[model samples]
Target: MIPVFVGMMYGATLGGNATLIGSAANIVAAGVCANEGRPVTFARFLRYGLPITLCQLAVTAAYVMVLSKFLR
Candidate 1:
């Protein structure tokens, strides 16, 4: 039960990286930053975000694999 919750929570949290506008908070942040005269272009965001997000997702996947091995 706890594992299920943890997995779901982590997945949902990670989904924030699924796209530039994947989450509401990200949109709000971008809007705020833009209004502050520091606009974050989608390309700029992706340049950094894509690699980090992919790496994090990979790590999470590996973790889940190991966790499943143990949990089983």
Candidate 2:
């Protein structure tokens, strides 16, 4: 249950960085969560979101670097 909850939060929050619609959806989801008593504050969301976003950026950068090197 905990894992599922985390996954959902990550999907609704971190997943927003992918697109405009996603960003809007995450905001709405956050509001809903707050109303339900979960209260996903900016700081709390950042705590989890930042690291994941950084990791994703790192991986994507590495993949592009590798491809560029090989293709060059």
Candidate 3:
């Protein structure tokens, strides 16, 4: 249960980074980019974000399943 909870938290954290609209820090980044006349698009974000998110989720799952014994 604890490992599952940790995995969920990590997954959520990675998801938060998936979009400029999903997190406060990224919102600021998007705003700044827009102000500079370099607005980021959803497609552009997904191109990079999707792979990163997948990798993060996979790593978190592996950790929870295989390394859970080391936790706590």
Instruction: Put the candidates in lDDT order, highest first.
Output: 3, 1, 2
Q: How far is candidate 3 from the true structure (C-alpha RMSD, Å)?
A: 1.8
Candidate 3's residue-wise lDDT over 1-72, tens digit each? Answer: 888888778888888887767688877887889999999887787788788888888887887887688875
Clashes of each: 0, 0, 0
Q: How far is candidate 1 from the true structure (C-alpha RMSD, Å)?
A: 2.6
Which candidate number would show the highest lDDT if scored against the true structure? 3
- How high a TM-score does candidate 3 get? 0.82
Q: Rate the local accuracy (lDDT) of all candidates.
A: 0.79, 0.63, 0.82
Report residue 21 deviation for candidate 2 (angstroms). 12
For model 2, the stretches where C-alpha displacement exceeds 4 angstroms are: 1-22
User: Could you tell which candidate, 1 or 2, scores higher by lDDT?
Assistant: 1
Q: Considering summed lDDT, which 10 consecutive residues are worst modelled in model 2?
A: 1-10
Q: Write the per-residue lDDT of candidate 1 for residues 2-45, one digit (tens) a residue.
A: 55766777777886775678788778888999999999888887
